[model samples]
Target chain A: MELREMSRLLYQIKLADQRVATSFERETGFSLTRYEMLMIVNDKGVCSQSEIQQEMKIDNAAITRHLKILEEKGHVQRERNVANNREVFVRLTETAARELQHCEQNHDQTNHLIAKVLSESEMQQLSALLQKLNTI
Target chain B: MELREMSRLLYQIKLADQRVATSFERETGFSLTRYEMLMIVNDKGVCSQSEIQQEMKIDNAAITRHLKILEEKGHVQRERNVANNREVFVRLTETAARELQHCEQNHDQTNHLIAKVLSESEMQQLSALLQKLNTI
Candidate 1:
Protein backbone atom coordinates (compact mmCIF):
# COMPACT_ATOMS: atom_id res chain seq x y z
CA MET A 1 0.00 0.00 0.00
CA GLU A 2 1.07 3.58 -0.61
CA LEU A 3 2.34 5.38 2.49
CA ARG A 4 -0.37 8.02 2.23
CA GLU A 5 -3.10 5.42 1.90
CA MET A 6 -1.73 3.45 4.85
CA SER A 7 -1.60 6.60 6.96
CA ARG A 8 -5.17 7.47 6.05
CA LEU A 9 -6.37 3.98 6.91
CA LEU A 10 -4.64 4.13 10.27
CA TYR A 11 -6.27 7.50 11.01
CA GLN A 12 -9.68 6.18 9.99
CA ILE A 13 -9.30 3.20 12.30
CA LYS A 14 -8.37 5.52 15.16
CA LEU A 15 -11.29 7.85 14.44
CA ALA A 16 -13.80 5.01 14.22
CA ASP A 17 -12.56 3.54 17.47
CA GLN A 18 -12.89 6.95 19.11
CA ARG A 19 -16.42 7.29 17.77
CA VAL A 20 -17.46 4.03 19.40
CA ALA A 21 -15.76 4.95 22.67
CA THR A 22 -17.40 8.40 22.74
CA SER A 23 -20.82 6.91 22.05
CA PHE A 24 -20.30 4.25 24.72
CA GLU A 25 -19.38 6.93 27.26
CA ARG A 26 -22.36 9.07 26.28
CA GLU A 27 -24.71 6.13 26.77
CA THR A 28 -23.05 4.53 29.83
CA GLY A 29 -21.47 7.48 31.70
CA PHE A 30 -18.15 5.68 31.81
CA SER A 31 -15.05 6.15 29.73
CA LEU A 32 -14.01 3.03 27.86
CA THR A 33 -10.82 2.69 29.92
CA ARG A 34 -12.69 3.07 33.21
CA TYR A 35 -15.33 0.59 32.11
CA GLU A 36 -12.62 -1.92 31.19
CA MET A 37 -10.97 -1.43 34.58
CA LEU A 38 -14.30 -2.12 36.27
CA MET A 39 -14.72 -5.25 34.16
CA ILE A 40 -11.32 -6.50 35.32
CA VAL A 41 -12.25 -5.98 38.97
CA ASN A 42 -15.71 -7.49 38.52
CA ASP A 43 -14.25 -10.48 36.72
CA LYS A 44 -11.61 -11.17 39.37
CA GLY A 45 -13.95 -10.36 42.30
CA VAL A 46 -10.81 -8.77 43.68
CA CYS A 47 -7.43 -7.96 42.11
CA SER A 48 -4.36 -5.96 42.92
CA GLN A 49 -3.55 -2.56 41.43
CA SER A 50 -0.55 -4.00 39.59
CA GLU A 51 -2.71 -6.70 38.08
CA ILE A 52 -5.16 -4.09 36.80
CA GLN A 53 -2.29 -2.11 35.34
CA GLN A 54 -0.89 -5.22 33.66
CA GLU A 55 -4.29 -6.19 32.28
CA MET A 56 -4.97 -2.74 30.90
CA LYS A 57 -1.39 -2.11 29.68
CA ILE A 58 -1.47 1.22 31.49
CA ASP A 59 1.16 2.81 33.74
CA ASN A 60 0.99 3.08 37.54
CA ALA A 61 -0.05 6.74 37.70
CA ALA A 62 -2.91 6.29 35.23
CA ILE A 63 -4.33 3.23 37.00
CA THR A 64 -4.08 5.03 40.32
CA ARG A 65 -5.94 8.06 38.97
CA HIS A 66 -8.72 5.95 37.45
CA LEU A 67 -9.08 3.88 40.61
CA LYS A 68 -9.17 7.06 42.69
CA ILE A 69 -12.04 8.37 40.61
CA LEU A 70 -13.83 5.05 40.79
CA GLU A 71 -13.39 5.02 44.55
CA GLU A 72 -14.67 8.57 44.90
CA LYS A 73 -17.67 7.64 42.78
CA GLY A 74 -18.34 4.64 45.06
CA HIS A 75 -17.85 2.24 42.17
CA VAL A 76 -14.84 0.54 43.71
CA GLN A 77 -13.18 -0.06 47.04
CA ARG A 78 -9.46 -0.42 47.68
CA GLU A 79 -7.65 -1.78 50.68
CA ARG A 80 -4.08 -2.49 51.57
CA ASN A 81 -3.09 -6.13 51.31
CA VAL A 82 -2.60 -7.68 54.73
CA ALA A 83 0.58 -9.59 53.95
CA ASN A 84 2.02 -7.04 51.58
CA ASN A 85 2.06 -3.44 52.77
CA ARG A 86 2.97 -2.20 49.34
CA GLU A 87 0.16 -4.07 47.63
CA VAL A 88 -3.28 -2.65 47.09
CA PHE A 89 -6.34 -4.72 46.24
CA VAL A 90 -9.41 -3.42 44.44
CA ARG A 91 -12.94 -4.70 44.13
CA LEU A 92 -16.16 -3.36 42.66
CA THR A 93 -18.83 -2.07 45.03
CA GLU A 94 -22.36 -3.43 45.00
CA THR A 95 -23.43 -0.25 43.28
CA ALA A 96 -20.82 -0.82 40.61
CA ALA A 97 -21.86 -4.38 39.82
CA ARG A 98 -25.50 -3.31 39.53
CA GLU A 99 -24.61 -0.38 37.34
CA LEU A 100 -22.27 -2.47 35.21
CA GLN A 101 -25.15 -4.61 33.99
CA HIS A 102 -26.87 -1.50 32.61
CA CYS A 103 -23.60 -0.29 31.12
CA GLU A 104 -23.08 -3.63 29.39
CA GLN A 105 -26.40 -3.18 27.64
CA ASN A 106 -25.43 0.29 26.57
CA HIS A 107 -22.08 -0.99 25.34
CA ASP A 108 -23.81 -3.56 23.22
CA GLN A 109 -26.18 -0.98 21.80
CA THR A 110 -23.29 1.33 20.95
CA ASN A 111 -21.44 -1.49 19.24
CA HIS A 112 -24.55 -2.42 17.31
CA LEU A 113 -25.09 1.11 16.09
CA ILE A 114 -21.52 1.31 14.78
CA ALA A 115 -21.36 -2.21 13.40
CA LYS A 116 -24.75 -2.05 11.67
CA VAL A 117 -23.27 -0.01 8.86
CA LEU A 118 -21.50 -3.04 7.40
CA SER A 119 -22.87 -6.39 6.42
CA GLU A 120 -22.00 -9.48 8.40
CA SER A 121 -19.52 -10.59 5.78
CA GLU A 122 -17.91 -7.17 5.75
CA MET A 123 -17.61 -7.21 9.50
CA GLN A 124 -16.02 -10.63 9.35
CA GLN A 125 -13.55 -9.37 6.78
CA LEU A 126 -12.80 -6.27 8.82
CA SER A 127 -12.32 -8.31 11.97
CA ALA A 128 -9.96 -10.66 10.19
CA LEU A 129 -7.96 -7.77 8.77
CA LEU A 130 -7.76 -6.09 12.17
CA GLN A 131 -6.62 -9.29 13.80
CA LYS A 132 -3.88 -9.58 11.22
CA LEU A 133 -2.78 -5.96 11.74
CA ASN A 134 -2.80 -6.36 15.52
CA THR A 135 -0.24 -9.18 15.30
CA ILE A 136 2.47 -6.58 15.90
CA MET B 1 -23.07 -9.89 14.22
CA GLU B 2 -23.24 -11.06 17.82
CA LEU B 3 -22.69 -8.28 20.35
CA ARG B 4 -19.70 -10.12 21.72
CA GLU B 5 -18.17 -10.43 18.27
CA MET B 6 -18.81 -6.77 17.54
CA SER B 7 -17.25 -5.77 20.85
CA ARG B 8 -14.19 -7.87 20.16
CA LEU B 9 -13.76 -6.34 16.72
CA LEU B 10 -14.04 -2.84 18.14
CA TYR B 11 -11.43 -3.69 20.73
CA GLN B 12 -9.14 -5.08 18.04
CA ILE B 13 -9.44 -1.89 16.01
CA LYS B 14 -8.59 0.18 19.08
CA LEU B 15 -5.62 -2.02 19.86
CA ALA B 16 -4.27 -1.86 16.32
CA ASP B 17 -4.60 1.91 16.20
CA GLN B 18 -2.78 2.21 19.51
CA ARG B 19 -0.03 -0.08 18.33
CA VAL B 20 0.59 2.13 15.32
CA ALA B 21 0.48 5.30 17.41
CA THR B 22 2.84 3.93 20.07
CA SER B 23 5.29 2.80 17.43
CA PHE B 24 5.18 6.15 15.67
CA GLU B 25 5.83 8.03 18.90
CA ARG B 26 8.67 5.76 19.90
CA GLU B 27 10.29 6.13 16.51
CA THR B 28 9.68 9.85 15.98
CA GLY B 29 9.78 11.38 19.48
CA PHE B 30 6.39 12.93 18.85
CA SER B 31 2.94 11.71 19.80
CA LEU B 32 0.56 11.21 16.88
CA THR B 33 -1.70 13.99 18.16
CA ARG B 34 1.20 16.39 18.53
CA TYR B 35 2.46 15.54 15.09
CA GLU B 36 -0.97 16.18 13.62
CA MET B 37 -1.18 19.52 15.39
CA LEU B 38 2.19 20.52 13.97
CA MET B 39 1.10 19.39 10.56
CA ILE B 40 -1.96 21.63 10.77
CA VAL B 41 0.18 24.62 11.75
CA ASN B 42 2.65 23.88 8.96
CA ASP B 43 -0.12 23.50 6.40
CA LYS B 44 -1.80 26.77 7.36
CA GLY B 45 1.49 28.75 7.84
CA VAL B 46 -0.39 30.59 10.60
CA CYS B 47 -3.83 29.86 11.95
CA SER B 48 -5.87 30.56 15.09
CA GLN B 49 -5.92 28.19 18.04
CA SER B 50 -9.63 27.58 17.54
CA GLU B 51 -8.92 26.46 13.98
CA ILE B 52 -6.50 23.83 15.24
CA GLN B 53 -9.03 22.69 17.85
CA GLN B 54 -11.78 22.52 15.26
CA GLU B 55 -9.60 20.74 12.71
CA MET B 56 -8.56 18.21 15.33
CA LYS B 57 -12.03 17.83 16.85
CA ILE B 58 -10.39 18.40 20.21
CA ASP B 59 -11.44 20.82 22.94
CA ASN B 60 -9.85 24.17 23.74
CA ALA B 61 -8.07 22.99 26.89
CA ALA B 62 -6.41 20.13 25.05
CA ILE B 63 -5.30 22.29 22.14
CA THR B 64 -3.96 24.86 24.58
CA ARG B 65 -2.00 22.24 26.49
CA HIS B 66 -0.53 20.72 23.34
CA LEU B 67 0.38 24.12 22.00
CA LYS B 68 2.04 25.04 25.28
CA ILE B 69 4.21 21.96 25.14
CA LEU B 70 4.98 22.60 21.49
CA GLU B 71 5.96 26.16 22.27
CA GLU B 72 8.21 25.02 25.10
CA LYS B 73 9.85 22.52 22.77
CA GLY B 74 10.39 25.25 20.15
CA HIS B 75 8.28 23.30 17.69
CA VAL B 76 5.60 25.99 17.37
CA GLN B 77 5.05 29.67 18.09
CA ARG B 78 1.81 31.07 19.47
CA GLU B 79 0.94 34.76 19.49
CA ARG B 80 -2.17 36.62 20.51
CA ASN B 81 -4.12 38.07 17.55
CA VAL B 82 -3.67 41.84 17.35
CA ALA B 83 -7.26 42.49 16.29
CA ASN B 84 -8.84 39.98 18.67
CA ASN B 85 -7.36 39.52 22.11
CA ARG B 86 -9.30 36.31 22.64
CA GLU B 87 -7.83 34.69 19.54
CA VAL B 88 -4.33 33.21 19.29
CA PHE B 89 -2.38 32.35 16.14
CA VAL B 90 -0.02 29.35 15.84
CA ARG B 91 2.78 28.58 13.39
CA LEU B 92 5.51 25.98 13.18
CA THR B 93 9.08 27.05 13.71
CA GLU B 94 11.90 26.29 11.24
CA THR B 95 13.29 23.68 13.62
CA ALA B 96 9.92 21.97 13.75
CA ALA B 97 9.61 21.92 9.98
CA ARG B 98 13.11 20.45 9.65
CA GLU B 99 12.52 17.84 12.36
CA LEU B 100 9.11 17.08 10.91
CA GLN B 101 10.76 15.97 7.69
CA HIS B 102 12.74 13.35 9.63
CA CYS B 103 9.63 12.46 11.64
CA GLU B 104 7.66 11.99 8.45
CA GLN B 105 10.16 9.40 7.26
CA ASN B 106 9.90 7.58 10.59
CA HIS B 107 6.13 7.77 10.39
CA ASP B 108 6.15 6.16 6.96
CA GLN B 109 8.40 3.37 8.22
CA THR B 110 6.10 2.82 11.20
CA ASN B 111 3.04 2.69 9.01
CA HIS B 112 4.81 0.37 6.60
CA LEU B 113 5.68 -2.04 9.39
CA ILE B 114 2.08 -2.20 10.54
CA ALA B 115 0.55 -2.26 7.10
CA LYS B 116 2.88 -4.96 5.79
CA VAL B 117 0.81 -7.51 7.71
CA LEU B 118 -2.12 -7.10 5.31
CA SER B 119 -2.25 -7.58 1.57
CA GLU B 120 -3.16 -4.59 -0.59
CA SER B 121 -6.71 -5.83 -1.13
CA GLU B 122 -7.14 -6.47 2.59
CA MET B 123 -6.06 -2.91 3.37
CA GLN B 124 -8.45 -1.48 0.83
CA GLN B 125 -11.29 -3.52 2.30
CA LEU B 126 -10.35 -2.50 5.84
CA SER B 127 -10.19 1.16 4.80
CA ALA B 128 -13.62 0.95 3.18
CA LEU B 129 -15.13 -0.71 6.24
CA LEU B 130 -13.63 1.93 8.53
CA GLN B 131 -15.02 4.72 6.33
CA LYS B 132 -18.46 3.19 6.61
CA LEU B 133 -18.21 2.79 10.37
CA ASN B 134 -17.07 6.40 10.77
CA THR B 135 -20.20 7.77 9.07
CA ILE B 136 -21.67 8.59 12.49
Candidate 2:
Protein backbone atom coordinates (compact mmCIF):
# COMPACT_ATOMS: atom_id res chain seq x y z
CA MET A 1 0.00 0.00 0.00
CA GLU A 2 1.10 3.56 -0.60
CA LEU A 3 2.20 5.09 2.72
CA ARG A 4 0.84 8.51 1.76
CA GLU A 5 -2.48 6.93 0.83
CA MET A 6 -2.63 5.11 4.13
CA SER A 7 -1.93 8.34 6.00
CA ARG A 8 -4.67 10.11 4.06
CA LEU A 9 -7.06 7.27 4.82
CA LEU A 10 -6.41 7.64 8.53
CA TYR A 11 -6.83 11.39 8.25
CA GLN A 12 -10.18 11.01 6.50
CA ILE A 13 -11.37 8.50 9.05
CA LYS A 14 -10.53 10.94 11.84
CA LEU A 15 -12.31 13.76 10.03
CA ALA A 16 -15.42 11.68 9.55
CA ASP A 17 -15.33 10.62 13.17
CA GLN A 18 -15.06 14.22 14.37
CA ARG A 19 -17.85 15.35 12.07
CA VAL A 20 -20.22 12.64 13.26
CA ALA A 21 -19.34 13.28 16.88
CA THR A 22 -19.95 17.00 16.43
CA SER A 23 -23.33 16.37 14.85
CA PHE A 24 -24.31 13.86 17.51
CA GLU A 25 -23.36 16.31 20.24
CA ARG A 26 -25.28 19.10 18.54
CA GLU A 27 -28.41 16.97 18.33
CA THR A 28 -28.19 15.14 21.67
CA GLY A 29 -26.00 17.33 23.85
CA PHE A 30 -24.05 14.18 24.70
CA SER A 31 -20.35 13.88 23.94
CA LEU A 32 -19.17 11.14 21.59
CA THR A 33 -17.37 9.45 24.49
CA ARG A 34 -20.59 9.38 26.47
CA TYR A 35 -22.46 7.99 23.48
CA GLU A 36 -19.80 5.34 23.03
CA MET A 37 -20.16 4.37 26.70
CA LEU A 38 -23.91 4.08 26.25
CA MET A 39 -23.36 1.92 23.16
CA ILE A 40 -21.17 -0.49 25.14
CA VAL A 41 -23.87 -0.76 27.78
CA ASN A 42 -26.56 -1.22 25.13
CA ASP A 43 -24.54 -3.95 23.47
CA LYS A 44 -23.93 -5.72 26.75
CA GLY A 45 -27.55 -5.19 27.92
CA VAL A 46 -26.09 -4.53 31.35
CA CYS A 47 -22.36 -4.12 31.90
CA SER A 48 -20.14 -3.13 34.78
CA GLN A 49 -18.34 0.20 35.06
CA SER A 50 -14.96 -1.53 34.85
CA GLU A 51 -16.06 -3.28 31.69
CA ILE A 52 -16.96 0.02 30.06
CA GLN A 53 -13.72 1.60 31.23
CA GLN A 54 -11.69 -1.30 29.88
CA GLU A 55 -13.50 -1.40 26.56
CA MET A 56 -13.24 2.36 26.15
CA LYS A 57 -9.56 2.35 27.15
CA ILE A 58 -10.09 5.11 29.66
CA ASP A 59 -9.04 5.46 33.30
CA ASN A 60 -11.30 4.70 36.26
CA ALA A 61 -11.50 8.38 37.20
CA ALA A 62 -12.57 9.43 33.73
CA ILE A 63 -15.17 6.65 33.52
CA THR A 64 -16.49 7.58 36.92
CA ARG A 65 -16.68 11.25 36.00
CA HIS A 66 -18.52 10.56 32.75
CA LEU A 67 -20.84 8.08 34.43
CA LYS A 68 -21.77 10.72 36.94
CA ILE A 69 -22.69 13.12 34.14
CA LEU A 70 -24.64 10.38 32.38
CA GLU A 71 -26.43 9.63 35.66
CA GLU A 72 -27.25 13.29 36.19
CA LYS A 73 -28.57 13.53 32.63
CA GLY A 74 -30.83 10.47 33.19
CA HIS A 75 -29.02 8.50 30.50
CA VAL A 76 -27.74 5.68 32.67
CA GLN A 77 -27.96 4.15 36.10
CA ARG A 78 -25.41 2.23 38.15
CA GLU A 79 -26.01 -0.41 40.75
CA ARG A 80 -23.60 -2.25 42.96
CA ASN A 81 -23.36 -5.91 42.01
CA VAL A 82 -24.50 -8.18 44.81
CA ALA A 83 -21.87 -10.83 44.04
CA ASN A 84 -19.08 -8.26 44.01
CA ASN A 85 -19.74 -5.22 46.13
CA ARG A 86 -16.89 -3.38 44.47
CA GLU A 87 -18.41 -3.90 41.03
CA VAL A 88 -20.85 -1.29 39.77
CA PHE A 89 -23.11 -2.28 36.87
CA VAL A 90 -24.23 0.26 34.30
CA ARG A 91 -27.29 0.12 32.05
CA LEU A 92 -28.85 2.67 29.74
CA THR A 93 -32.15 4.26 30.68
CA GLU A 94 -35.03 4.16 28.21
CA THR A 95 -34.37 7.78 27.45
CA ALA A 96 -30.78 6.86 26.68
CA ALA A 97 -31.92 4.06 24.41
CA ARG A 98 -34.08 6.47 22.46
CA GLU A 99 -31.33 9.06 22.28
CA LEU A 100 -28.86 6.41 21.23
CA GLN A 101 -31.17 5.29 18.48
CA HIS A 102 -31.42 8.83 17.23
CA CYS A 103 -27.66 9.27 17.25
CA GLU A 104 -27.30 5.90 15.57
CA GLN A 105 -29.11 7.20 12.52
CA ASN A 106 -26.44 9.88 12.11
CA HIS A 107 -23.79 7.19 12.52
CA ASP A 108 -25.56 4.98 10.01
CA GLN A 109 -25.85 7.82 7.55
CA THR A 110 -22.17 8.70 7.85
CA ASN A 111 -21.16 5.07 7.39
CA HIS A 112 -23.45 4.85 4.44
CA LEU A 113 -21.94 7.97 2.94
CA ILE A 114 -18.44 6.66 3.43
CA ALA A 115 -19.35 3.38 1.79
CA LYS A 116 -21.22 4.95 -1.09
CA VAL A 117 -18.06 5.01 -3.19
CA LEU A 118 -17.34 1.27 -3.06
CA SER A 119 -18.99 -1.68 -4.72
CA GLU A 120 -20.30 -4.57 -2.62
CA SER A 121 -17.27 -6.73 -3.37
CA GLU A 122 -14.90 -3.83 -2.71
CA MET A 123 -16.64 -3.21 0.59
CA GLN A 124 -16.16 -6.84 1.54
CA GLN A 125 -12.46 -6.67 0.75
CA LEU A 126 -12.12 -3.43 2.67
CA SER A 127 -13.90 -4.98 5.64
CA ALA A 128 -11.61 -8.01 5.56
CA LEU A 129 -8.52 -5.80 5.40
CA LEU A 130 -9.69 -3.62 8.29
CA GLN A 131 -10.50 -6.75 10.31
CA LYS A 132 -6.97 -7.98 9.70
CA LEU A 133 -5.57 -4.62 10.82
CA ASN A 134 -7.77 -4.63 13.87
CA THR A 135 -6.62 -8.10 14.83
CA ILE A 136 -2.99 -7.04 14.35
CA MET B 1 -22.40 -1.34 1.82
CA GLU B 2 -23.70 -3.42 4.66
CA LEU B 3 -24.45 -1.01 7.52
CA ARG B 4 -23.34 -3.37 10.27
CA GLU B 5 -20.14 -4.16 8.45
CA MET B 6 -19.50 -0.46 7.93
CA SER B 7 -19.98 0.16 11.64
CA ARG B 8 -17.52 -2.62 12.43
CA LEU B 9 -15.05 -1.11 10.00
CA LEU B 10 -15.20 2.22 11.81
CA TYR B 11 -14.76 0.46 15.14
CA GLN B 12 -11.74 -1.38 13.85
CA ILE B 13 -10.28 1.84 12.48
CA LYS B 14 -10.62 3.39 15.91
CA LEU B 15 -8.95 0.46 17.62
CA ALA B 16 -6.07 0.56 15.18
CA ASP B 17 -5.71 4.30 15.61
CA GLN B 18 -5.56 4.02 19.37
CA ARG B 19 -3.07 1.19 19.16
CA VAL B 20 -0.80 3.11 16.80
CA ALA B 21 -1.09 6.31 18.78
CA THR B 22 -0.27 4.52 22.01
CA SER B 23 2.74 2.86 20.45
CA PHE B 24 3.94 6.10 18.92
CA GLU B 25 3.53 7.91 22.24
CA ARG B 26 5.46 5.20 24.06
CA GLU B 27 8.31 5.43 21.60
CA THR B 28 8.50 9.17 20.91
CA GLY B 29 6.97 10.78 23.98
CA PHE B 30 4.87 12.81 21.56
CA SER B 31 1.12 12.74 21.52
CA LEU B 32 -0.62 11.72 18.31
CA THR B 33 -2.07 15.20 18.18
CA ARG B 34 1.43 16.64 18.28
CA TYR B 35 2.61 14.33 15.52
CA GLU B 36 -0.36 15.30 13.40
CA MET B 37 0.48 18.96 13.88
CA LEU B 38 4.02 18.33 12.80
CA MET B 39 2.83 16.41 9.75
CA ILE B 40 0.66 19.34 8.72
CA VAL B 41 3.55 21.75 9.08
CA ASN B 42 5.86 19.46 7.16
CA ASP B 43 3.38 19.11 4.34
CA LYS B 44 2.80 22.84 4.02
CA GLY B 45 6.53 23.72 4.30
CA VAL B 46 5.72 27.08 5.82
CA CYS B 47 2.00 27.39 6.51
CA SER B 48 0.01 29.96 8.38
CA GLN B 49 -1.50 29.08 11.73
CA SER B 50 -5.04 29.48 10.42
CA GLU B 51 -4.27 27.26 7.45
CA ILE B 52 -3.01 24.31 9.52
CA GLN B 53 -5.84 24.68 12.00
CA GLN B 54 -8.44 24.73 9.22
CA GLU B 55 -6.94 21.78 7.36
CA MET B 56 -6.76 19.74 10.55
CA LYS B 57 -10.30 20.78 11.45
CA ILE B 58 -9.19 21.84 14.91
CA ASP B 59 -10.07 25.02 16.70
CA ASN B 60 -7.61 27.91 16.81
CA ALA B 61 -7.24 27.46 20.56
CA ALA B 62 -6.46 23.76 20.36
CA ILE B 63 -3.95 24.24 17.53
CA THR B 64 -2.27 27.11 19.35
CA ARG B 65 -2.02 25.07 22.53
CA HIS B 66 -0.46 22.08 20.79
CA LEU B 67 1.92 24.32 18.83
CA LYS B 68 3.05 25.90 22.08
CA ILE B 69 3.95 22.49 23.52
CA LEU B 70 5.58 21.41 20.25
CA GLU B 71 7.62 24.62 20.16
CA GLU B 72 8.66 24.07 23.77
CA LYS B 73 9.76 20.57 22.78
CA GLY B 74 11.72 21.95 19.81
CA HIS B 75 9.53 20.24 17.22
CA VAL B 76 8.36 23.38 15.49
CA GLN B 77 8.95 27.09 15.12
CA ARG B 78 6.33 29.77 14.65
CA GLU B 79 7.32 33.10 13.17
CA ARG B 80 5.45 36.15 12.13
CA ASN B 81 5.19 36.42 8.36
CA VAL B 82 7.45 39.19 7.07
CA ALA B 83 4.86 40.37 4.54
CA ASN B 84 2.05 40.38 7.09
CA ASN B 85 3.10 40.86 10.71
CA ARG B 86 -0.32 39.75 11.90
CA GLU B 87 0.07 36.33 10.25
CA VAL B 88 2.05 33.62 12.01
CA PHE B 89 3.71 30.86 9.98
CA VAL B 90 4.64 27.44 11.33
CA ARG B 91 7.43 25.19 10.08
CA LEU B 92 9.07 22.05 11.36
CA THR B 93 12.47 22.42 13.01
CA GLU B 94 15.41 20.20 12.10
CA THR B 95 14.82 18.32 15.30
CA ALA B 96 11.18 17.74 14.36
CA ALA B 97 12.18 16.64 10.87
CA ARG B 98 14.54 14.06 12.33
CA GLU B 99 11.99 12.96 14.89
CA LEU B 100 9.22 12.78 12.29
CA GLN B 101 11.37 10.70 9.98
CA HIS B 102 12.16 8.31 12.81
CA CYS B 103 8.51 8.02 13.73
CA GLU B 104 7.62 7.52 10.07
CA GLN B 105 9.19 4.07 10.24
CA ASN B 106 6.54 3.08 12.74
CA HIS B 107 3.87 4.59 10.49
CA ASP B 108 5.27 2.79 7.48
CA GLN B 109 5.50 -0.49 9.33
CA THR B 110 1.94 -0.14 10.58
CA ASN B 111 0.67 0.56 7.06
CA HIS B 112 2.69 -2.32 5.70
CA LEU B 113 1.30 -4.69 8.30
CA ILE B 114 -2.24 -3.52 7.68
CA ALA B 115 -1.87 -4.07 3.93
CA LYS B 116 -0.24 -7.48 4.18
CA VAL B 117 -3.58 -9.27 4.06
CA LEU B 118 -4.63 -7.60 0.85
CA SER B 119 -3.45 -8.34 -2.67
CA GLU B 120 -2.00 -5.55 -4.80
CA SER B 121 -5.28 -5.09 -6.66
CA GLU B 122 -7.19 -5.05 -3.43
CA MET B 123 -4.83 -2.44 -2.08
CA GLN B 124 -5.44 -0.27 -5.10
CA GLN B 125 -9.18 -0.63 -4.78
CA LEU B 126 -9.04 0.09 -1.09
CA SER B 127 -6.90 3.13 -1.73
CA ALA B 128 -9.31 4.31 -4.36
CA LEU B 129 -12.26 3.83 -2.03
CA LEU B 130 -10.58 5.73 0.79
CA GLN B 131 -9.70 8.58 -1.61
CA LYS B 132 -13.35 8.74 -2.65
CA LEU B 133 -14.45 8.85 0.97
CA ASN B 134 -11.99 11.62 1.67
CA THR B 135 -13.49 13.70 -1.11
CA ILE B 136 -16.96 13.10 0.26
Candidate DockQ values, in order, are 0.43, 0.37
Show the colliding residue pairs in model 2.
none
* Residue-by-residue lDDT tens digits, candidate 2, B1-136: 4333454555555565565456545655666566667787898899999998888777899988888888898888889999999999899999889877776665654345545555566656655655554554
- Candidate achieving the largest DockQ: 1
- Model 2: DockQ against the native? 0.37
CAPRI-style quality class for the chain A–B interface of candidate 2: acceptable
Q: Which stretches of candidate 1 lie over 4 Å from their true place?
A: A1-8, A77-89, A105-112, A116-126, B1-14, B77-90, B105-112
lDDT tens digits, residue span A42-125, model 1: 889999999988776667999999999999999999999999989999999999998987756655543567656887888788
Per-residue error (Å), model 1, residue B111: 8.3
* Candidate 1: residue B34 Cα off by (Å): 2.4
